[model samples]
Target: MKRYICFIALLAGMVACKKDTVRKGNDPYRETVVPAIYINKDGISPTRARVGEEVMISGKGFEKNKDKLAILFNGVKAAIISLTDTTVRVKVPAQAATGNVAAQVDQQYFFGPFFRVTGVFEMDTLYPSLVGANGAINNIIPVEDGKYLVVGDFTDYGNSGKKDKLNRVARINHDGTVDGTFGPDAKNGTNSTVASAVALPQSVNGYQYLVAGSFNNYEGVSYVNSVALLNNNGSLAANRIQSPNGKDITVSALKGGVSGSVNNMHVQPNDGKILLTGNFRFYVQPNFNLKTVGTDLDSVHLDSIQVNGLIRLMPDGGIDSTYNYDLAKHMGKEGANGFIYRSLLLPDGKLLIAGSFTKYNGQAVNRLARLNADGSLDASFMPGAGADQAIGNMERQPDGKIILTGSFNMYGGVKVPHIVRINENGTIDPGFNAGEGTDGFINNVGIMPGGQIILSGVFTQFNKLQRNNMIVLNADGSVHATYNSFGGFSAVGDNGANGNVNTVSRVIPQAGEKSLLVVGSFTKFDFRTANRIVRITYP
Candidate 1:
């Protein structure tokens, strides 16, 4: 009995010491020691990776004994693409929501303790294609259901004979199919009137209002020179407002007015006020209830430069009088000389406008400027980034950084073409360089929720290593190794007589899984389709 009691006490004390050792987090002895994970590679992971590429995970920690090693994905058995004594590689599952996907490795040690480990599987993509036309995409907004409304001067796709049937707006589906429900043979869910640029579209007044601007005069016949509203279905939209100033101009008569030419526009979400910008002397609102004379020449085509200012339309589609101002003087009279084509409403209730100009408000400013909603210029916002190139498109990253795309070769004295990210205050990000020996132009860019940036335009390679046209760079500015697959590329140039029109105009991401919208003049898509606008997905 004494011996039995002694043994029981001794065993209990040993168990207690082991438990205390682990719990105390201090004693090295009596604690289970895990073998440190290492790369059988004897070096760090390779930095350069092509899309859809995978990395090897061969190492001694787990592979030394299959009986002791096991790997799992999100706690489930991992779908191993490949593995060896020194490496293990896995494919990233698709449509994996914006979150972390963990790779865990558990290896039992011959000495005693187990080695449990984990890592991450990063996924992204890069799409490439032949170049197309040269133009800015204006007024891209989503419509009811799954339709998209895009208004621009791209009358034809791939030089094909596709007309802007109902003015210039076309309602298309996520799959790149035109919605026949919006126009005649072509349906635009906006106004039938032609505005150089139109607002996305909204349901207002007795009908849906699609605001449009003009460059010429309206003869009430075919030469329409004013802003017009069309119904929800691209029919001549009508707005019912008590012409605040007791005067109203019908949409058709805006051409001959004071601000006859409206080249760009912005709609206020707060009050549905329409801001029309163009090269005009002062803002003009139509008093169509009176016999109004149209544009200066009774035609939409005015050879001379017109006024450069802004006009405000009330929610009721009537002109707002009490709230009005001149954009020319506001944008710095001397600097607001060029046409304003791109405008974005910043987070701080200010407006940022970009165009072809070297100065703003008499001060040295590149092609971009910031304006208060009341037309006052924001001085603090200078050439935030891409100071070297002309910014073709800029999108605010989820991290509040700015991703600018344009044609400026020398960035920070280093040649990183196609894309560049700027810090919040507009400083060049050195850590996020796409690396050296790269060339091409980035036309458009937007970030998906997962922090992966999808960039499109024209480029043959990235990271001085990979080939991708529209590529999704990792959040760290590195090529997401598990991006799109590697494939052969065919170099294409304009075979047409008009050489300038043959380049990638832009690339638009759609709402479907691995779905994208590519707009360019290349009739041959991925060496397949002859259409200018195309939809591509993973096979």
Candidate 2:
């Protein structure tokens, strides 16, 4: 009886051991629970967005690790703005065609409904028939009735159906068609004219334009050098512009003569007078040889009384002697021939100038200085220590503050990144700070309707974020966190490695539109082929 009992106990032990082994093999902790992803918990907020616009993506199990997840708009990769376990924000890739949104987390792939990606700005490919310029378009001004005045070194303008030989300056219709009535026929012996700057019409009827460049004549007959006033019909105006004592604005490379070209011009807001700045040393009036000058002129001469490079002109083209600011005395020696690059007339009649000079009126002023309406330095407005480098541009805000962009890393003894905002008193605003700012030089700054600022330059990053050549900033100086440039600006066929914009000369916001016109030397934008100029939709 004892042996039988022992055998029964052994059998029970073996059965119990087998049950324990099976339980261990099926341990709950050892079993893999594949992560599941769900999208649009609140339903996709927007089913459509333009390229470069941000779209909100909400879901679960997104994985805390951004590297473990991939987001795509259509087939192109969308740039992640921010990520969390339950939500993600990304910008629609500029290169993305219309396509669906997809997210890959770990080994699982989740797709949302199809989303439409639309273009933000349209290109001017058909009408103006750019064809491509032999030179570069240096500057452009928007005129009345949707026309644009373009200045550059090109010699031809037209479409595939028709071609017009445009000198350096030409007026184009909104569609890029050359305005035949605005100037003399291009083929009429005017082979080469290089206009560097143009000013808006000073007349209320918009019938006149002020042009400055390195040209000795117009229409192969009118002898005008460097400066000329044109009528709406492309003929010389009734009055000729000349130096105070009657000589030409002689600009040459030789010493003792005017040595630089006029780079910019601005018309006074209150008065029709004009303001000019460059590296030249004198200004001579054009000799029409008549008591009352008319459209037709006889001969122009460059030998006459010398004037400073910076000068204000009367409506009739005579130098405004009352508004005198000695450019030579105020602009101290700037190594390598530095000169004023830009100037702005303030609402209060003050003048702000920026350049590479180190002194203003013999006072230690870095790259920026302000002058009273009478051309005297404003002693009350002080910029301490000024900028560490050259200031490229300046824009005023409605609140009387100034926005500046340049290659500078410091301003007024404070570490102000490349872009900075200063109060009307010329003191840096503590509220405006761009941490580390841009990595390259900024050429232009444009303001949007709500005071949002758009910056364009050769920069690759802003505040340590990849912004490429263009970036948008909130009024408070914070990065437009959701703005993305994909790969920014680059030349076409650059193999995706070089995304730097070679140069961005201008950034102009379109009137009554949320788009911006970017003109520069770049041939591509956001990884797409865009010759010299492209319009981007700002979202």
Q: What is candidate 1's TM-score against the reference?
A: 0.57
For candidate 1, write residues 1-539 as lDDT tens digits.
99999999999999999998878786556677666444432221332233233434445554554443444222223345655566666543321112112334454321211111111322112322221222223445556677666554444222223344434555665544556555544332223333333444444333354545553322232333445554556555433333334543345412323345565566777766666665555534433333225633222232222235554556554445433333353422333656554555567656666555556556665666667666666666544432454656677776777776666665444566645776656557776766542356565566665677666556655555434355567777876644433221122445643221323444445555655554544444333333345455532
Tell me model 1's lDDT, rounded to 2 decimals. 0.48
Alpha-carbon shift of residue 411 in model 1 (angstroms): 6.4
Candidate 2 lDDT tens digits, 1-539: 99999999999999999998997785667778665777874345486778778888888766565787778765567888887778888888755544457888677777876665655333433432234333445667777787776666656444312245666666777655567766654432133444344555446646667777666555554445466666666555543345444655432211111224666677786787776666666656544434335544434344443444566667666666566533555432222135687777787787788888887656777888887777667888888888899887888888888899887888898887777899988889988876777877777787777788877778756766545577777888887644542445654434755544434566666678665666656665554555555656645
The alpha-carbon deviation from the true structure for residue 525 of candidate 1, after best TM-score superposition, in angstroms, is 3.1
Model 1: per-residue Cα lDDT at residue 194 = 38
> Which runs in model 1 stand beyond 4 Å of their true positions?
1-140, 153-167, 173-176, 184-223, 226-228, 238-264, 276-335, 339-341, 382-386, 409-418, 465-469, 486-514
Where model 2 places Cα greater than 4 Å from the true spot, the runs are: 1-134, 157-164, 175-180, 187-206, 221-223, 238-259, 287-300, 325-338, 485-487, 491-502
> What value of lDDT does candidate 2 attain over all alpha carbons?
0.64
Q: How well does each candidate superpose onto the true structure, as a TM-score?
A: 0.57, 0.67
